[model samples]
Target: MAGQSLGTILGRAFRLRCPKCGGGRMFSGLLRMHDRCSECGLVYERDPGYFLGSSYVNYGFTALTLTPAYVTLHYAFGWTNTQLAFPLVGWVLVFPVFFFRYARALWLGMDVYFDPQSFEDPAESEQPEPPVR
Candidate 1:
């Protein structure tokens, strides 16, 4: 698959099942990854260099998902900015460590399912695709 189906993609974003086959579990636990998909032979490690992007993803997900929650909690609980932000921001700051491993695994799986050339056999690198007529 060039990419997983929409349901699978959402599941991936939610850190759910394997995106390709959509049935097997992707993570060994909350943040640990299986070396390969039980359903498809998708290797969990797409590139050792890939996870460098995990920081940015972790930050983005944090901002998108948590910022509104932070604001809402402040209003709902009658929390002063300092009162709310202190502990909440501290929690937000720590969220990345807990999230990074899953995010790194996500980046790897994304490269696998979404990268056009990802699943192609590296041994055939010298071969060319048939030219369109």
Candidate 2:
């Protein structure tokens, strides 16, 4: 965060790349994230339930999107609640699933940005992997 801009942070996050190095991918698949960065070995989940905060990011974005869409469709388009219910409900269900990875990535990026010290280069002091649950 010292020299990295917001754009760079979001760019790396959106691309699902490692926050520190921007070289390693954060996820190996649609829903599976690597334990550590391949390029820099930065541990992705710093502690237990680390990604739980990402749910806030997901919910916040969903509300922001939903509120405006609901308002616009209801007022401007004169769409009734019934007309909007199905699509909006569907969106509420699916959008979070689709945005799951992104929300986690954004949360990680913001966390790294705000607490750079917490995410220091792992090469300096290797961290033991957490025991498999």
Best by lDDT: 2
Model 2 over residues 1-133: C-alpha lDDT tens digits? 2546678889999999988889999989999999999998888998999999999999999999999999999999999999999999999999999999999999999988888767765564577889999
TM-score for predicted model 2 compared with the true structure: 0.88
Q: Report, for every candidate in turn, its global Cα lDDT versus the true structure.
A: 0.68, 0.90
Alpha carbon lDDT at 26, candidate 1: 68
Best by the TM-score measure = 2
Candidate 1 lDDT tens digits, 1-133:
3445555565664665665566667677766777777886767666676568877888887888687877787777677887776777787888887887667756655665566366655664556879999
After superposing all C-alphas onto the true structure, candidate 1 shows an RMSD in angstroms of 4.5
